[model samples]
Target: MSRVIIRLLLTLLFLCPILAHSQLEDIDLKELVAGAQEWAEENLDTNVLDALPELDRQKAQKFLRDLQKQFQGEYVINLAALRETANTILPLLESHEETRPYAVWLRPRLDYLKIADEFLITIPPPKVEPGEPAKPIPNPGPIQQRAVWIKEVERRPWPPAASNHVARLKTVFIAEKVPPELVWLAEVESSFDARARSPVGAAGLFQLMPDTAKRFGLSLWPRDQRLQPEPSARASAQYLKLLYERFKDWRLALAAYNSGEGTVQKLLERRNARSFDDIAVYLPAETQMFVPKIEAVLLRREGIKLAGLVTPRD
Candidate 1:
């Protein structure tokens, strides 16, 4: 009898709150979980079809499932975190489709990705001499001249404000010695357009991926901070700093930014190549084209004939 009473007490205690809440709010945990899962799966499938290779598709799909399992205990989906993971796999997404699917499930995540890209575009790493600065040499080798041209093309320009914004960026990119001209890279990248978005889902002035932005400390929460020019630029600078540190070459860093870091890393591993032109051939088609575009733009900006070439969009 005592045992039965204890069991009854336990049941009442457990049931009372649920009954009360059901009457007042009508919450359904199972329904909510099902809806979230369905939404996630549909979105994952779209990304898989649009951006992944067959082998990578399988891996990415499994990763998404793992995300679901990882978040099963939580009631709400942390879309920002999940989206970051997805953007890292974007290179895999390109072969399958020319553009991102604009479905509701995919749109928000892509928006976040764009914000990240913009942020990364703005901030680049500092340029540092690998060793103690040698006394100014009378002449660098042939390789040095080519490296200088490569640096000239990757430069980013300061925003409208020359002193303030430019100085701030220099601080974040402290890892390596940055060329002064390459500061314009961000300008050509998105015309300092914070809200800028690429067709393939790259976004902002820096045009960082969602994952890259988040990894570099930009928040893609309800609203992504990457769409803000100054902040995005700072983030982009930070990411570039990391890339330069890893590759120790400006051209390779730029190429890595435009294409998959993985692809560039693999190429570097396989070849004894040191020049951007050599490594560039192994990169994706878009990146090969990217270098020349940057070069042309820089040339135009510096030339007197094209004095009024770049005008801010209204």
Candidate 2:
């Protein structure tokens, strides 16, 4: 047999007798590790020391330190550190069958260390480098940036391509006893596309379906007046006003607009909810994201309005 295997056999032979005579929990764990290491190191130069590189020896040494930390007072396992150190050691040892057995023997001891930790709060591993890699900074995602950017855009004090239509709808919204700013709904609904027609038959700047347009006094007989910006904005605004009256919350009203009033109302009643967020979980995928989309656009419009008030810096 290879010298490493003979060494491992001798080490285990020594440890196995001690292990059998004493329960692992009852014995001093440090002694258990020290005894194993002392046996592994004894007569080192005379045995397989030439076959085992210094790097492998260093890994074993670190493992000894790790074992001390893991089984010492207030015993705890640093799982992440244990895993990382194991990664470093396993590859070096597993190339040879004799050394592989050491890893096999060590696995149970590693598991035993975890069993000893009293809580999630582990003893931090000794610092190996300057700063930890995973900490120090966090990066935002596109969706998060989209939400923030959209709100900041709303505060700009200038009108956009869609603003003229919003101005036209002011009288319409006022006539419907709704907030004029809500005309931004049309921009989100149809992108102010007066000729906008959905595959589902929703049309105009407001995206009102034929039946909805008919109820609001629009005609499709002569021509689909649902395609007219003026009348459609009036209809869209009136619908918003109607929804606000029913739900008594503008955000929920907007969610109703996106998800269908009946659907939203049922979710609210089923959930015993009064806020959009509470019922939002049950909303359709489009509606789930649509409300925030509208708010982003609305906030951008608000930004434009506010930006207009700021005097030129230069």
Candidate 3:
């Protein structure tokens, strides 16, 4: 072989691993989209389409377009290529933390992609004729279906006793600089019963478990401080703030509050899913309904008489 051929071969050998590593990272991101789709399909209640802002849609669209350019050499999507891409990303996502939610959320949309024979198709512009006005292109079928899931949450049956504690919880949450609207959550947990105790040992209006109570500075040694309304309310607010920081979404934060942050975190790992709604079906039945119950109470308190039970959102 000539010296030039040998040099080129050596250079390619050196660059191969670096290129492979880059592709691995790219695959993880693709898995995130897939996982999100999966979760959305798994939980039929919430609309992943409506929750996203314009910027997020644009970002996802851009990411999808980038992947298309990378893999769609001939400009046609095929099942084998899509399957190979999914297999590469799903395993890597199993152990991931931060991006795991996105993966869980995106994976299920593959059915729609396969059925529709595309990922996301552009809504075509209006068609015009020589004399007639332009006829607007209709919203595509998948997007229209996705939009159907977006509905307003309805009010729940509020225990009269629950409203009695709202004034106190408002004080506690406002003192902590958290949203006072969260006061409604206690209504779902324990019907605002200060001395309430769950079958699993969660106590007080918030029904915090033992470890969670201790983590928020509750003294359970000489006496169970979780039974006290004032201390328990404060601790609950503080804990919710921490959960909000961790999940960055109120619904997920509340899920952590109900099921233990560790439980939710582990659940996120297991499903590689997104928000509470995305992975709701995989959670304990009580934990699954926790956020919706909270939303229902909030809507009732605000005097919005919605008829049906809509999915809870962030």
Candidate 4:
């Protein structure tokens, strides 16, 4: 078995019970395995898959079953193992142009995995009562995560790609009547790599999803306009401006940007909440971390708080 297969198998074995207990009991495990196998066969390079020594079919099935779960799990601790897997897979993904976009997706997210690992090591778990039913260990809240990212982002030098792209991208955002400082969003989304693409179909420096790109008048066919820096930045700025108009707060607008507007809206209505912090805990773990990470990035790169950002006056 390839080391990737072995590691995934171990992770699936270790996390299956935890996953089953945590709201995923209704999922059909075999179906998930089949789906992953199908995706790998279709989308991944045949040569790359062949290079990974084959595992027994049953073992491969078992390992692949929870592969997505391991990456998307709500728990931060689960991410520690994936950091190694991502490191191993990155070079392989970069080896082929056909798969390089997936590498772009994974590269920016590696820091997230690293930070989650450090979060597990550095932050002590919450205390439980002696006789209380054990509960999932909660991830650090937005304020705590902001502090963590402040330290994490401060130590790193600016991404080299940012120097080449930020000026041009800022001009696009300004033309769209959005704050130029918000152009740093590309740093958080794609490290200013215009070629960046998410596995789920988001693309370009702004990482605009097809639906959002289309809604903003960008074309998906005859070439994905999302991969074009200027067009995508214009779309992104328009979307962000619309999100801000809906939410009225930069933090809430950003939370909507990451998690979807309906998600933030539903949570707000459900909780009778208006602020991001009020509904932050109920949001997906990724979005919970995302807004603060953006805030931290803005502060580090521009010396501006999220609240300090202002859309350009017409």
Whose lDDT is greatest here?
4
Q: What number of backbone clashes does candidate 2 have, counting pairs of residues 3 or more apart or in separate chains? A: 17
Among all windows of 10 consecutive residues in model 4, the one with the lowest summed lDDT is 16-25
Q: How displaced is residue 1 in candidate 1, in Å?
A: 63
TM-score-sorted candidate list, best first:
4, 2, 3, 1
lDDT of 4 by residue, 26-94 (tens): 333234333544543342223323333344223322332333344333565555667776777777657
C-alpha-based local distance difference test score of model 1: 0.46
Each model's backbone clash number? 38, 17, 21, 0
| lDDT tens digits, residue span 57-165, model 1 | 6755655554433233121113234556666554454433322321212322343233223323433434557885543212222233334434444454444533444
Q: Which stretches of candidate 1 lie over 4 Å from their true place?
A: 1-180, 299-314
Q: Evaluate model 2: give its TM-score.
A: 0.48
> TM-score, each model?
0.43, 0.48, 0.46, 0.78
Using lDDT, rank the candidates from best to worst. 4, 2, 3, 1
Q: Which candidate's TM-score is highest?
A: 4
Q: lDDT per model, in order?
A: 0.46, 0.52, 0.50, 0.68
Greater lDDT among 1 and 2 belongs to: 2
- CA-only RMSD, every prediction: 20.7, 27.6, 19.8, 8.6
